[model samples]
Target: MDMKKDYDLLRERAELLKVLGHPVRLCIVRGLLNEGEKNVGDMQECLEIPQSTVSQHLAILKSAGIIDNSRQKTENYYHISSPLAKELIEVLFK
Candidate 1:
């Protein structure tokens, strides 16, 4: 096997898992999977966390390509983007 290529991919997966290691991020991912698409306001309400905190966690998930958002007028609705995250969410939460 190509060690470098495998290591690179594993490194990326590890980083994504690392980003998900936080409790808030874990709940946010699980929430998106369970609740479907939502905006920062919806996440804030459901997670019972500050808007800024939710946004920060959302940013991390977005950067890791675990979730994505769509703009509808003034609101940005986010949803799970990575199939791996989706699968992990289902397996871990279910």
Candidate 2:
């Protein structure tokens, strides 16, 4: 294994793990994987957290390229866009 050659990949994996390290964030991803796409309202309801808090976590997940959202009129529906994230969640649950 060449650390120098794979440094970028390692860094990206580290960042992903860091983003997922949060309990809320991990729960959010796991929910998406199990339930398919969801809006902020739906997530907030399920998480029992403030909508703002859910949005904040969503922003971090989005910025990290772990999730993506589609605007449907006024509501933005989010889904897991990263295959790595899905695999990680599956591994964790199993």
lDDT of 1 by residue, 3-32 (tens): 999999999889978988999999988988
Candidate 2 error regions (>4 Å) = none
lDDT of each: 0.91, 0.98
Q: Could you tell me the lDDT of residue 90 within candidate 2? A: 99
lDDT, residue 58, model 2: 100
Using lDDT as the measure, which candidate wins?
A: 2
Expressed as tens digits, the lDDT of each residue in 23-81 for candidate 2 is 99999999999999999999999999999999999999999999999999999999999
Per-candidate TM-scores read: 0.93, 0.95
Where in model 1 is the C-alpha error above 4 Å?
none
* Candidate 2 lDDT score at position 93: 100
Whole-model lDDT, candidate 1? 0.91
